[model samples]
Target chain A: MILTVTLNTALDVTYRVDRLRPHGSNRVRAKAERAGGKGVNVARVLRALGREAVVTGFAGGTAGAALRRELAEAGLPERLLPIAGETRRTVAVVDESAGDTTLLLEPGPTVPAEDWERMLHHLGRLLPGAAAVVLSGSLPPGVPEDAYGRLVRLAHDHGVPAVVDADGAALRAALAAGPDLVKPNADELAAATGLADPAAAAAALLDGGAAAVVASLGPDGLIASTPQGSWRARPPRPLAGNPTGAGDAAVAALTLGLVDATPWPQRLAEAVALSAAAVRAPLAGDFDPDVHRRLRPLVDVRPLHPPRSA
Target chain B: MILTVTLNTALDVTYRVDRLRPHGSNRVRAKAERAGGKGVNVARVLRALGREAVVTGFAGGTAGAALRRELAEAGLPERLLPIAGETRRTVAVVDESAGDTTLLLEPGPTVPAEDWERMLHHLGRLLPGAAAVVLSGSLPPGVPEDAYGRLVRLAHDHGVPAVVDADGAALRAALAAGPDLVKPNADELAAATGLADPAAAAAALLDGGAAAVVASLGPDGLIASTPQGSWRARPPRPLAGNPTGAGDAAVAALTLGLVDATPWPQRLAEAVALSAAAVRAPLAGDFDPDVHRRLRPLVDVRPLHPPRSA
Candidate 1:
């Protein structure tokens, strides 16, 4: 089973309104609530793809209770550490008329030092039996920048592969521990490598210590680099809809590929096809089975030059 | 016992922040939640002043649960009618530096017609036992403008004194029922009567059908007009603090006075003194007992000619 970590969990609230007026009272026509965090999104996508995924993180207070209840209702396995403060809430105002969305995001509750240490200690206990672990999303306050790096080293010590999905300092810090795979979108890769080209950025990350680096190009699909081979895969065309969690879908496919020992080319092709299918799903982290089946045949995988070892 | 009705109930969330930047994310340093509606605030103050206040109206969903839990925690009795939708939440960002507040209020959930009838029916059962019934706050959707009017008539039908603490059509409609008293702040009174002068506005409302009118003039104290007499009662002075719920405190004092048979001159003095004390109590209701006692002696209550009989 895949284990995922999300330090900053939120109760996501979406309100459907006819129009949004600043500083004006609104009567929300419809409202929905869901548990949210990057790793939680990844776990949800894995579940949608028929894979077993367990979520672990710090959840607290009433909002935390609501989150756990929602996870139970959604049938997701979770082992959340209770903290002292309430979990945060993020609000999204969806104005369907003009097709523009305005988001009001809350930066969640601050995690205490003891809570952060407890989460790491919890990860130490769970890593041994897990085949692969995912360390994702922003680190809440009190968790150091090298947190993901520490988790990566712990996973390596336990003989478990770790997939790191983050950006900025946390992503840069995780590379020295040699994660099995690192997924950064084109812009994030550019920021990490100080290179403008996506292909060159992926090469720099692989050289830095990642066993394989998959550069997600969003609408252009994905470019994968590994020790044995490198490949570029593209969907027939860009899928239409909200692309919020398509990358999480790709992470699900990558995790499955590693566990099943699928060839690099086939894994890259599957990841692209699944991601395209995910965009068309109404809610994030879900793929329409029909769309997935229809798009799988259109993914084109081609060999690319392997990066030169230093 | 004093009975208060809150048609549009809200979960009032207070967040402490250094400042408020529109369209930007905010991390609340301090957080608190409470059930809020004008009538609810009145009931809370009454409880603090050692009075039994029974609160009623609509409440629903998880937010409603939170509201009930908070009210119970505060040691106040509640008889909220559970509706299908959750109550609205109003966010107050308090910037301690500037001592200024920005309010983001949501239009409360619309009550269904059947639910409205149930609430009215609940009032019917409770009105007979109340010494005074206080109808306060805005009318939620699906509740008619004449709702307060109908409720006022209900109280009078049972020979109980009724006070209407609302604005616009709801206040206008309630006046037709000739409630014992109507309290409108300077702004509400101005809007309702189209008169900028507080004394003139109070007289206009009294002439319109209300047996009496009490115009709350913020730090200037209160002015009341009855067919028997008219008087102005001003407090000693103002204190340093948030003045958000001062008006509600005034209402609480007035209601308590009427029920306890405190003479009108003393009632006017008590309302002003209690409202001043509320400024010192911050978010919690009830004036500082010592300060209230001290200021009560200084309240200047002088009689004048009543509005010339129409």
Candidate 2:
């Protein structure tokens, strides 16, 4: 079973309006809500792929209860540690006429030091039977900066592969713990390594002890570098829809491949196909099975030579 | 004890940002949430005035639970009836730089016919000991359009005074039920009667069997017409601040006066003073006691002559 960790969970709310008028009253035409956070999304995708996945994290207050309820209704297993502060809500105001979305993100509640320790204790119990562990999303306030690094070490101590899907300093810190894989989108890779070239930035993370690095290049697809070799994969054509959960889909595919010891090229191809399928789905943490099946065989994975200097 | 009914309750969320840009992401600098709706505001203000207020309405789902939790934390007594649909949320995006607010309102969950009956049954029990019953806000979907009219009748059956704070058909219907009082702002009165003159519109409701009509005139203060006499009251000067809950505060003061059987001029003066104080407060359902005390003595209430034609 795959174990997914979302330190900062959210109740995602989407409001649809005819148009968003600044400083004006808007009557929302419709609304939809779901439990969300990067690892939660990954777990959802993993479940869709017929894989057993368990979610663990810190959740508190009314919003946290709501999130847990939604997860239960969705049949996603969760073991959330309780805290004093309520979990955050992330709202997306979708303009139906303009086809645009404006986001209002609440900085999640602060988790006390004891809460973090308790979460670690809970996570330690789950790691024993996990095929692979995913440490994803931003660290909430009061959680140490090296939380992902510490989690990576915990997974490794249990002889389980860990995948770190994070950005900036957290990503930088996790690399030294030698996570089995790290997935950073184009912007995140640049932000973490300060390298304009995706390959160079990915290479930097690989050198910092990540066994492999897969960089999502948005519509352009993904570039992955592993100890065995390097490869780039892309969907047959660019697909446009909600891209919110595409990265999480890729992470799910990558983790699945790591558990099965799939070849790097095959794993890269699967990640690209699954991500494109996620983009076609209307909401995050969901994908069209038909679309995934059709695109899987068509994904093009090609070998890429390392930079001459490297 | 005062009884306030909020047929469509809400979780009022306020997000403060540097500025509001339509169709653009906003990083909220601060957030505050509370249980709110027209009658809920009235109940909160009544509590602030040292009156015991009991709130009852339909509440269900996650949002409803959150609203109940907030009300509990605030020490507000509630007898919310259960429903299947989740409660709605009204978001106010406050632009600190522009000094303006953008509102996004969800049309609340639908109430089943059985739910309405259950609520009426519950309200019937509370009316016996109630000093007054306030039917406030718009009726949610599935509720009969003449809901307030029925509620007014219920109150009168128990020999309790009823106040209706509503608009359009609901206000028109309640007038025929002979509610003890009806409060409509200038716009609502005009919309309900299709008359531009506030006095003429108010007279129409009085003619329709309402015992009294009080029209809120925004910065101009309040004009009240009752069988006893007609009066107009204004604060020393127009107070400018958040006007979100000013009318509810006015309703609270008017309800208090009705229970105490205060004279028309004194009641109107109290309403005007309390409303101005509410405007100075940071949030709805709250007022500055100091401001209320200062404005109360200075409010001017004077006899008003009927329109020449009327």
Candidate 3:
């Protein structure tokens, strides 16, 4: 079974409005909420794909309880640790008329040093039974800057591969700890390496000690730099829908590829297909199965630079 | 002790942003949340004023639990009935640069028929110990339109004065049940009675069967029409701050007057003063006590008409 970590779990809420009016009272026409964070989204996709995945993270207060209850309802197994502060909420106000969304993201709870220590101890225990460990999302305030790096090292100590899905400093710091794989979206890739080209940015991460780097470019598809080879994969047709969970879907596919020791070309193809399928779903952490099945076969994978030796 | 009812309770959340962008992501700099509904706000003020107030109404789901916890934390006694549906949330996004707020109000949980029956039974038990029963705010979907009216009738049956603070159809329906007093802001009065003039609009409500009507006129102050007489009350000077809970503060002061059998002029003066004090406070359920005390004696209450006997 694989393990997914969400250090900054959130109660993701969505509100539908006729047309958003700034500085005015808006009566939400419809509302929806679920437990979310990048790792949680990856775990959701993993479970939906028939892989066993356990969610581990810090949850607390009423919003945390709500998050836990939702995880139970969704049947996503959890090993969440409780804390004193409440979980944060990310609200997406969808404007029906304009067909756009405005987001308000609350800064989640601050983690105490002792709580971080407890989390490290807890991860050590769980690492033994996991096939691979995936660390994802932002670090709440008060957490050490090299949190992912620390977690990556711990997973290694247990002889389990660690996949880091993060951005900015969190993504950069994890490289030295040498995660088996790191996934970053297009913008995050640029932000992390200060490089304009996806391939260059990914190579920089590889040079920094990551075994492989997969960068998701919405609609454009997935580009990967790995030890075995380099490849670019794309779906035959662009799917138009929410792109919120596309990156997580790719991470789930690529992680499965790592566990199964799939070839680089097949792994990149599957990642692109799954990412495209997720875009076809209305909400994050969900995908249209038929879209996945249809797109997977049609995904076009080509050698970007061939094997490093070649 | 006053019994305050908030059938549609809410987790009122506020987010402070540097500036609001209509179709962009906003990182909230600061956040604050409290249990709120018009009735809840009234109860908060009543408690702050050292009045004994017990809150009773329907609350459910996690948000309901949150509301209950806050009420407990604040030490306000409650007899809230539990339900199955989740409570709603109201988000206020404050734009620091714009110096304005945008509100997103969720349609609270829908009440089942059995819950309404259960509430009447619950209120029946509490009325005997109550000096006055205050029914405030909107009725959730599936609740009877005449919910406040039915509540008023129940309070009257137990020889308890019922004060209603609502607007539109809810206010209109409650009037015919003959509540002792109804509080409506100027816009609510216009919406309910279709009269532009504040005093005239209030009179229209009295004709619809209310024993008295109090209309809040924002910074202009308040106007009251009751059995004894009519009067217009104003603060010595206009004060600045959030006006979200001004009306609730007024209702708190007026309900206390009813319990104490204060004269009409003194009651109106106190209501105006308290409302202004609430405007000075940042949150709705709080008031600036110093402001309240300083402004009370200076409130100018001019008789709109001589006592009916005179």
Candidate 4:
């Protein structure tokens, strides 16, 4: 089973209304809720692709219990640690008439030191049995800035590869631990490296200590920079839909590729295909199976040469 | 204890943000969640006024569980019946910069026939020991349109008076069962009786079988039409903060007056004062006790005579 960790997990709630009236009451036509955070979403994608995945993180109060219940209902496995503070919720209010969405994101709870230490111990045991462990998302307040970095070292101790999907402080901190892989979206790549060009940003991450880096460029597809070689993969055509969880879909495919020892080209192709499929689907962590199947072979992969002794 | 029934309860969630950008993601600075519905709000007001108030209603799923937990924390006793469908949530996004709020109200779960039947049995067992039962709010789908009516009849069976805080079909239907009292805001009163005038609307509700009708007219205070006589109560001056639960505050005061057999003028004065005090508070179920006390006796109450056989 692939183990995933989400330190700041959330209850993702969607409210569909006929129209959103600013400063006025809106009657929601429909609503939905689910467990979410980068790692949890990655686990959900892995499960959808027929891979066994288990999630571990901090959950507390009513929202935390509700998150656990939803994960159980969705058939996603979790062994979340209980905390004193309530888990946060992210509300997406969709305006049907305007065809736009407004989001309200709550700052998640602060994890106590004891809870963080307990999590490392929990993951230390689970990592040995898992093929790969994913460390993702932002650190809740009260946790060390290098929270993911510590998890990476723990994975290495268990001889398990760590797939780090985070940005800013968490990403930079984890890079120092020499993670097996790191996935960042366009904005995250730029933020982490302070570079305008994607390739430059990707190269800087490698210099900083990551073994490999995969940057998701949304509709432009993904770029993989590794010691073996660098490659850019693009979907045959742009797909129109929600792009919220597209990166997680790519991460799931890439993690599977690591486990199966697939070639970088083939892995990048799979990542691009699955990501496009996720975009075409409405909710995050869900993809159109048929789209993924049909688009896999058509993905365009090409090698990128390093700068000639600049 | 005064028993307040909220047929369609909600988890009232409030999110505070520095500014609201419609169609864009906003990070919430703070958030809070509590048990709320018209009846729940009324019960909270009663409790704050040093009255022993207990709440009863259908609570199901995570939101319902959260509601019950909050009620316990508030020290309000409850005997809620569980149902299959999840209770709804109401999100109030407060924009601090704009100084306004945007509400997203979920259409609560449809209470199945079996669950509602079980609720009736639950309430019947508790009604006999209650001084009065307050049936408030809209009926969840799958419950009868005359849900409040059934509860009013049940209260009568126990020799207990019934107070209704409802509008539209629920209010109109309950009046036919001869509830001891009914409270409606200006819009609800207009909708229930098709009368533009507050006094006329209150009279219509009384004629429909309610023993008394109290209409909350916002800053204008309240108007009461009872079998004894008619009177209009006005606050000394307008007070403003948040008017969301002003009517529920009024209902809380009126119900207490009924239990104590207070005179109409005094009851109207109390209702007007409490309602205005609620308007001076931020949340729906809270009021400034100082404001209430200062405004109570200062409320101007005057009797109104019916048109002479016109």
Candidate 5:
């Protein structure tokens, strides 16, 4: 079974308002909520595609309980470590008419040192049986940026490959531990390497110690680079839909490839197909099974441009 | 024991932000949560003032459970009726530098017919021995406009006084049921009576079948009218604060008066003093004990104009 970790999970709430007027009260016409964190989203898509994935992370107070209940209802298994404070809620006021989403994110509760250790202990036990472990999302307060690096070494110690999907310092720290794979969007790759071109940024990540790197270019599709080979794949035609969880979908496909020992080119093609399918899905990380199967064969794959002459 | 009813209870969440910009994403710096609804606010204040109060009304799902936990932490007994949907949250974005507050109110979940019946059954059990029943705030969907009226009649049938604090049709409907008291802010009173003068509106409410009426005039204090007498009690000085829960504080004082059978003049004075004291307190419905005591003598009470010539 695939293992996913979301250290700073959130109860994602979306409220539909006619319009959002700052400093003025607006009435919501409809509301939707779901358990959220990068790893959680990845696990959700994995399950939707008929994969077994368990989510483990920090959850506390009422919001945490709500997250667990929502996950259970969605048929996702979660092993959350309890903390003292309530989980955070990220509110998105989506204006139906304008199609604009205004986001308000709370930093979430601070995890005590004891809770952090407890989570590490739990993860240590779960990593042994895991086919691959995916660590994603932000680090909650009181957790050091280097926590992911430590977890990466633990996964390796248990003979399990690890996939890291995070941003900023945590991503930087995790890269030094030689993760099996790292997935970063165009902007996140740019920030990590200060490189404007995706090719240059992907190379930087590969050199930083990842066994390989798959950089998501959104509508531009997926690009994968390894020491032995490189490949590129994109959808037939651009899809129109919310692209919120496309990266998570790609990550899920990548993990599936590792578990099944699929070749790099096939893995890249599958990741591209799943990510495109996710963009067309209304709810995040969910793709229509029939559509997914139909689109899987359409993913066009080719050799990427040779790495920059450095 | 006092029974407080909040038809549309909410989980009040306050998020502190350094600067709030419209159409831009913001990260909340700090967070706080409390059980909120006008009647819940009154009950919390009553408990803080050394009174025993039981909060009864709708609460459901995880957010509702959080609301219950907050009430318990405040040391108040809660008899919340569970429903199918979760309670809503009212977001208050506080800007400390400017001392400005931006409110984002969620309409809360709708109450099913069964939920309403369950609440009525609960009230039926509590009304007989209750000193007073306080019905407050906006009614959730699936509840009739005459819900407050029905509750008022129920209280009267059991020989218990009812104090209602609401706006528009809810308050008007309660008046037709001859509730022991109705508390309307200046705007609601004007809209209810079509009279610009608050005192005249108070008289109109009493004439409309209400046993008594209290007009909350913001920092100007309160105007109270009953069959026995009419009076005005003005706070000595106008103070500025987030006036979110001042009216709830006034309702708490009014409930206290009915229980003690205090005369209208004294009741008006207490209401004004409590409201003023609330402005100085940090949280909603909370009054600084010292300020509450000090403001008692400053409340200026004057006899209302005798029944106007027809």
Candidate 6:
């Protein structure tokens, strides 16, 4: 079973309104809610792909309880540590007419040092049996800056491959721990390495100690780099829908490939296909199975020249 | 003890932001939440005034549980009956720079007929020891249109006074049931009676068998009509602040006066002072005690002419 860690778990709420007018009352036409965080989303996608996945995170207060209940109802396994502060909620106000979404994200609760320590201790016990450990999402306040790095080291100590999906400093620090894989989207890639070129940024993460780097290039598809080789993968055509969970679907594919020891080209192709399918799904943490099946054989993965020196 | 009924309770959530732009993401600067409904606000204000107030209504689902927990934390007495549908949440997005609020009111979960009957039976047991019953707020879907009228009859059957703070058909129906008092703001008064004149519209309710009619005239204060006499009351000057709960505060005072059998002029004066103080308070269901104390002695209460037609 693969283990996924979301340091800052959230109760994701979506409100659908006929039209969203700023500074005016909006009567929501419908609402939907689910448990969400990057790793949680990855774990859900993994389960959908017929893989065993367990989610672990800090959950507390009423919102946390609600999140846990929803996860259980969805049949997603979770081992959440209790905390004093309430969990944060992320609200997406969807404009039905325009089909646009406006988001309001609350900064997660401040976790105490003791709580972080306890989580680390708990994670140590679970790392040994995990096929791979996926560390994802933003670090909540009060957590050390090198949290992802520490988790990567712990996973490596247990002979478990660690996959880090993060941005900025967290991504930078995790790279230093030599995580087996690091997935950064285009915006996050530039933000972390100050490189305008996705291939160059992915190569930089590899040189910084990550065994492999996968960079999501939005509608342009994905670029990946490793010490042995490099490749670029994209769907036959861009699929348009909610892109919120596409990256998580890619991470799920990458982790499954790591467990199977698949070839780099095949892994990149599968990641692109799954991501395209996820984009077509209405909500995050879910992918259209039919779309995935149809797109899997059509994804184009080809070798790329190593980036020229920075 | 006073019993306040909030047929449609809510978890009132406030999000403070720097500015509000339509169809744009908003980063909330701060957030606050509390249990709220017209009668719930009345019960809270009554408790602040050192009166015994017990709240009862339908509560269910995760939101309802959170609302109950919050009420318990605040030490407000409640005995809400369980229902299948979750309680609604009302979000107020307050733009700090503009000092304006945009409201998003969720249509509450539909109530089944059996749930309404169960609540009525539960309320019957609590009414015997209650000094008065206060029916307030909108009736959730599936409840009968004459819900408040039925409650007023129930209170009279037990020889207890009943106050109805509602609007439109519910107010009209309750007035016909001979509730001891009915409070309607200017807009609600006009909607219920089809008359723009507050005094004349209030007298129409009296003619419909209500013992008294109190009309909240916003910044202009309150005008009250009773079979014995008529009176007008206003604060020394309009209190400028959030007016969200001002009308509920007035209802609290009116209910309190009914329990004490206070004179009409004194009741009107107290209602005006409390309502103004409530306006100065930042949150609903709370009043500025200092403002209430200062305004109470200065409130202007005087005789008024009876309506010409009704």
Model 2 C-alpha lDDT per residue in residues B39-133, reported as the tens digit of each score: 99999999988899999898888779888989999999999998999898999999999998999999889999999999889989999989999
Q: Candidate 1, residues A1-310: lDDT per residue as tens digits?
A: 9998888887877767677554444556777788888788889988887888999988987778888998999999998899987788766666767665555556567788888888888998988768899888788777888988999999999998999999999999999889999999998999999999887788889889898899899989998888877788999988888677788889888988987899888888889988888888766667777878888878999878854453
List model 6 lDDT by residue over A31-118, tens digit each.
Answer: 8889999999999999998889999989988789989999999899998899999899888888889989888777799999999999
Worst 10 residues of 1 chain B by lDDT: B19-28
DockQ values for all predictions? 0.23, 0.77, 0.89, 0.87, 0.64, 0.64
Estimated TM-score for each candidate = 0.80, 0.96, 0.97, 0.96, 0.91, 0.95
Model 6 alpha-carbon drift over 4 Å, by segment? A306-310, B306-310
Task: Show pairs that collide, candidate 3.
Answer: none
**lDDT, candidates in the order shown:** 0.84, 0.91, 0.92, 0.92, 0.88, 0.91
* Candidate 2 vs 6: which has more lDDT: 2
* Candidate of highest DockQ: 3
Candidate 1 lDDT by residue in tens digits, B1-310: 9999999988988767666544445556677799898899999999888888999989987788889999999898999999998788776667667676655566678888899889878988988889999998999988987999999988888888999999999999999999988999999999999999887888899889998899898888899988767888887765677577788999998888778878889999999888888887767454677878889989988876654555
Best by lDDT: 3
RMSD of candidate 6 to the truth, in angstroms, is 2.3
lDDT of 5 at B49: 83
lDDT of 2 by residue, A280-299 (tens): 99889999888899999999
Where's the lowest-lDDT run of ten residues in candidate 1 chain A? Answer: A19-28
Kindly list the per-residue Cα lDDT of model 4 for residues B207-300, writing each as its tens digit: 8999999998999999999988899999999886899999999999999999999998999999999999999999999999999999998999
Residue B13, candidate 5: C-alpha displacement in angstroms: 1.6
lDDT of 3 by residue, A154-194 (tens): 99999999999998889888999999999998999999889
Winner on TM-score between 3 and 5 is 3
Task: List, residue by residue over B134-252, the lDDT tens digit for candidate 6.
Answer: 99999998999999999999889899899999998888778878999999999998998898888888888888889989999987899998877788898898768998999999999
**Which pairs of residues clash in candidate 2, taking residues 3 or more apart in a chain or in different chains?**
none
Fraction of native Cα contacts reproduced by each candidate: 0.12, 0.81, 0.94, 0.98, 0.70, 0.62
Name the regions of candidate 4 deviating beyond 4 angstroms: A306-310, B306-310
Q: Candidate 6: which docking quality band?
A: medium
